[model samples]
Target: MLKENLVNILRTLQRERVFLLGSFVTLLIILGGLGFSFTEASEGGSFLKRFGEGLWWAVVTVTTVGYGDVVPKTSEGRLVGVALMVGGLLSFSLVTATVASIFIERKFRRERGLETLKETHHILVLGWHHDGETLLDQLLRRLPHTARVVLINQLPPEKMEGIRAKYPGREPLFVWGDYSREEVLLRANVRQAYKAVILAGRNEGETAAEVDQRTLITTLTLKSLSPKIRILAELLRMENKPYLERAGADQVLIRGQYDSSIMAGALASPGLYKVVDALLNAEGFTVWAVDVPSEFQGSPVKTFSDYLKNQHQALLIAIFSEGRALSLEDLLGDEPSSIDEFIRSKFVETGMTHLFGRAKMKFQINPADHQVLGPHDKAVVIAAQPPNL
Candidate 1:
């Protein structure tokens, strides 16, 4: 409490520094001179008369409104009055400047404080309902390191703990305000933000269109202020999607009545949801891209098995030919004419044949397939490291 009081006192003193300093100095000079000069010079009088005269002089001198009502008779009193008059002019000016500086500073500080509170870059989610939490959770999970996610909702801090816990290190800056207010947009720093996602509260009895209309006003205001910020809004009805898109939303993620179709399918086939989940989760039979190498240009499929065997360390699938086949003789090269004759002649060396189909076929030539091979222009080979099954 003492620390807080001291801080408050310091701030107050700073705000009124000029006025306080001038007022105090003016009082000290007036009182000091009055007491010393009046004691020797003034004729014996009531204490009240002396008190009133001293106060009158202090006020007039400090305000630079000197009216010659009472003149100092003693040389000492006159000297003090001359000093007070000079001091009074400087103090009056100081007081005026202090008041003006405090007023201007307060206005600018309030604006800057609001701006700092609303700094957001990635998203501005407008409601704190269950769906809002779910949406935030999904986004946070997908982009774990995202820095700025802003929430504009009136829910108190206690109710937002779930979001805090789920995100762990990522918590959005929250603002308490009505979504329809223009000031709320300014508070959220919507102008400099990247995108906005507005959600409707489930408890609100109003139609989705009605709720969306209020959100749309905020979106339009934000867009007008910052034309580059993309808006992604949510709607309860599918019919409202077009309206939201027309209202300048880059994308409107809306709830549709199409869930019934999925439910009907699920009821007919119990395993449908499982299959859908597998595909969506990327848990099975994933697709991967392997870059082609520069060394395998014009090399025969049977000549590059070392890639899959030694380098890739995976199964060698079939290789496909790329581009139109050049001269048949160049493709056929020097393959044995007949298997029986070549074997009889003790020449059973296997060689690549250029022709029967667009691409050549080889059986488990893993070592040759593993060689650095260029990408095919026509077809790609499918290789996979099968999980233990």
Candidate 2:
């Protein structure tokens, strides 16, 4: 852990270039102090004879803020002082120029989306479409203000600037490159990202199949880099959903999958689509799914619903679970039964070994009122904000 922390600190300093400035300053101070103390040693009981006093004198001299409180009384001491003064002027000028150059280079790199990010647990949005700005806006609205985001794409710097301008204080970092490439992902710090949202690219002249293929490759690359990262991917065709899932995406959303149903509903009943749109896109209120609190375990669905409504002003409309969850140890058992071997063999044969330790997610909307809440059960509700409970 200590070594890992040290590596992380070094990585941060390297990215920020703070170590350069610190090392230069420390070296100059130490050398100046040692030289001053040795040269003034003949002056017995002189404050400059002490290393601490020499350091103070060195600081004032290097900064050219001579207080005249400590002066060299001998030829050797004066020679040392002259050397320090010349070194200080030359060194500080070089340092000032170098610092300015560094800042300018960093700014240029950032504006051109060529900078490597150091943000951890940030959300990564890869690829882009014509309506990508809307997706970014929604993500920013849903995420907390403290949440960091990095966007990886080939969009122009001007486009990125316009997008940043739209959100005054919540602008996301940008990396200009092909999102499917591992190098670009590394530049965006994909290994440290909490989650990644892969969108189907609408690059000029690219077909839908090509776009879906790119999305699949991006998902595979991301999972290889960070197996624990949660990936939410968009698919242009419903047929590509299983491929994306096999690529290790946590969730796959097919473009316009619900459009037909919504359109039919709107035709059958006037204003139905408007209601659906409001529920999904309206300000102030939206749907959320929260795990059942321990205190409400085994409570009836109706009871829990009532509690949410009364305590948090949230309307509970559904109770659901992500299927029957099981751990690897539970499936394998201590004795390693034939059944365990059989399950393991099947997972390996299907090239879905990763799924062996994961539960398949499924949602059951609006369960019976008398149904009791289980440990894995979650309540789906419409609320202004997430409830504290």
Candidate 3:
């Protein structure tokens, strides 16, 4: 491992020739200063004072600072100063160009999606649009300041710049590419991400199938990379639901389903949509997950709700259970209609599929108020204050 690391260091130095050259020049200047300082000390000068003066002279000459507070009276020291001043000019030019080139290279990498991110447990957003910006705003408001968010989208660096400008004080890294490609996904560090929110990708005049197809492709790639990551995907067609789950999506939301329901309700009763919107506002209501208490096992659901509200000021809303999330019925159909089912079922038993999807939860909303709570059940609650993470 040490030998491999040495080889990598050598390769890095070779690539960063300007850095190597600058270091060499600095060493040479320091050695020259030390020699001159020692020579002066031999002539009854204080060693530390002479050495500090020599170093100061070397820096001032190199940077063209030349404050002229101290000067070497010896002929040999003057020649040394001239050589250092010349070398300093060269080094200064090299350093300035190197810094500029580094910025240009970073710009190109951001434009072409070539940089690999090294963050852990950050939220990875797969698709860019107005929805991406809205999600970012909501995430910042909900999460702490230290939380990081990354985007993998087809937006140019210019649009990404606009995003940064519009959302000042927060910097989000973005990779520009088709997120389904393994290289692009790795560039975004999908395996290390905590959760991925995949918005359906579409262009102007594109069909629903085409948009959901892109989302499916991205989901499959994400699942292939990390099964443990929580994946929330959007689907336009309800028929495409099983496909997304089989691709290892943890939470699948149908497009227009929530909005259409709210709109229909509004039609029946004017201003009903406003009430629902107010209730679901990102800042107004918070949905949190709470641990199941051992004492509440087999107790009535209403009893648990009362305990939570009285103790923690939270309202019991739903039960989130990891069990029953996946089954032969979901992967296959009511009947095993084809040989494909045999192969696919066995394929899912592989390590990768088990890693990503086997831990998915089945959220049951408003379990009968009088129903008994199970041992492994979690209460999904709406509360003014957040539950412990």
Candidate 4:
């Protein structure tokens, strides 16, 4: 293991040209020291006559320090000193230029969005549209100050800078490219991401269906690369929701689905829209879905509600369950019949295995106080921030 590590280190130094420069400098120092000692050997009482003193003089001369404490009086010794001085100037200048060029190249790549990111567990946002700025603002507001976010799109560097300036401290990394491409996704380190949001982007002269098609393709690609990444996708048409769901999206939302209802409510009752907008976009507080603790498994909904209100100052608005509530035995039934086996085989052959155990995420907006909490239940609450529980 040690030998392998040493070889790796040597390879890196060679790639950086540090090894070559170091070897050259070492050779010059050794030759200069030996020559000085040999030439000054006849000068009795001269410090340079000693090999150790000669080495010290060589070090000082090569570094351009010129301490002048041990001077070489002989002609041959002075000639060695002149050679060391010229070599020192050339070597140090090359080293400085090499270091500066490396830094400049890295900066250039980053600005062009050509640098690959290595962040893990980061939020990935794919595609950009008219409402992208608003979406980014809400995400930044809800996320913790230390959380990382990466944006994959074809936005210009200047536009990215403008977006960063708007959000003061929370700057999302930008990777410029066609987001549907696998190479671009890999550059953003999508496999290690925690969650992804796919937006319905608007391209020049493209219809709603065309936009939805792009979203579907992106969802399919993301799931194929990282099956575990949770995806929330947007659709321009409500009819395209199923396509996104089958493409392995965890959540599918239609654009403007609630706008009509909110607008109607505003017409019926004044100031209704303001209240709803505040809840959705307010920085002080927002609605959050929190997992129910294990200790709350068979407790009544009213009890959990009271505990949140009293202990954490949070309001529990509803109790909901995500995905199918099924056990391992239930999922893989008592025994697969001949017909079941045949159907499973067909699904695998058709590349529709994703639909075998698929279940829609269900939410119960409000439940009776007597409702008992299930093991996989989650509490929908309104609080200043998500509760630790």
| Cα lDDT computed for each candidate against the true fold | 0.56, 0.79, 0.75, 0.79
In model 4, what are the clashing residue pairs, if there are any?
none
Q: Comparing candidate 3 with candidate 4, which one achieves the higher TM-score?
A: 4
Q: How many backbone clashes does candidate 1 have?
A: 15
Clashing pairs in 3: 227-356
lDDT of 2 at 332: 52
User: Residue 147's C-alpha lDDT in candidate 2?
Assistant: 95
On residues 1-389, what C-alpha lDDT tens digit does candidate 1 reach at each position?
57865765468657678647765776765674465346435644666676567667656665667787755666776666777777776766667777677668754543233323535465777775666765776566444375678777776655654455566567766666775577877777777687777776654577766776766566556555565667767777776564454345665776645578667867888698666545334454322223344465556544444454455444444443345532234422164454223222221122222221222322222235334344552223333332111
lDDT order of candidates, best first?
Answer: 4, 2, 3, 1
Q: How accurate is candidate 1 locally (lDDT)?
A: 0.56
Give the local distance difference test score of model 3. Answer: 0.75
State model 2's lDDT.
Answer: 0.79
Q: TM-score of each candidate?
A: 0.45, 0.75, 0.75, 0.83
* CA RMSD, predictions in order: 21.8, 6.6, 5.3, 5.6
- Alpha-carbon runs more than 4 Å astray in model 3: 1-14, 30-77, 96-114, 144-146, 165-171, 293-300, 311-313, 324-330, 333-355, 359-364, 368-370, 385-389
Residue-level lDDT of model 4, residues 70-165, one tens digit each, is 889999889989999999889877766766776687678776778777778899999998889989988887788888888888888888878877
Q: What would the per-residue lDDT of candidate 2 be over residues 11-60, giving only the tens digit for each residue?
A: 75566665676677667777778877887887676654467777887888
Per-candidate clashes come to 15, 0, 1, 0
Alpha carbon lDDT at 84, candidate 2? 75
Reference-based TM-score, model 4: 0.83
